[model samples]
Target: MTVETIGWNTAQRRGFGELIARSWSDAGLRLRYEREPAEVLAEYDIHLAAGTTAPALPPSPGELVVETFNAAEAVPPPPCMLSICFCLQPDVKR
Candidate 1:
């Protein structure tokens, strides 16, 4: 099994959600997001922090899980994390 993770800071979750909501109905935007996520995210005013990089979306959809952390107190919690796990077939040698 191969696992991939995408991380979004606390501040960017809302904008990222907006992008995802829009992409649900906009095919072009969806394709564009897949190809150029940073550019698309900029449209939502979601910019990555210095030295941070956004991971490319999975080649094809498989098992995906979105997790958000929330503390009991009013203090902010950790960033939003998305995990994707997929099984890859082993290479066969002839």
Candidate 2:
């Protein structure tokens, strides 16, 4: 699992997830959002524990989280962010 973690740093962008999303997108990686990494990894983006779950699914065994106090939740939201996990499904393998 090529997991990447960006720790908390004032210089770092707020909202771990929001930054991750933008980074992934910039890398040309298609992603979706969910609350469970295990389940969402198979379909959408990474799962956020403190995040909301639409169609809930059991979280994965090992989870990676990037915590930050400067989250983009401040008014006027700083571009937003979220964690994303993904698994290459059979269809995608082809």
lDDT of each: 0.53, 0.35
Q: TM-scores across all candidates?
A: 0.45, 0.17
Kindly list the per-residue Cα lDDT of model 1 for residues 1-94, writing each as its tens digit: 1112345565566556545544544578789987877788787677665666764433433434433323465267544344422122225221
So what's the TM-score on candidate 1? 0.45
Q: Listing every candidate in turn, what is its Cα RMSD in Å to the true structure after a full C-alpha superposition?
A: 14.8, 15.3
Per-residue C-alpha lDDT of model 2 across residues 9-82, encoded as one tens digit per residue: 43222233333443343333223333333453333333434453333222432434434433356676444243
Taking the candidates one at a time, how many backbone clashes does each contain?
A: 0, 10
Q: Which window of ten consecutive residues has the lowest lDDT sum in model 1? A: 85-94
- The residue pairs found clashing in candidate 1 are none
- Candidate number of the best lDDT: 1
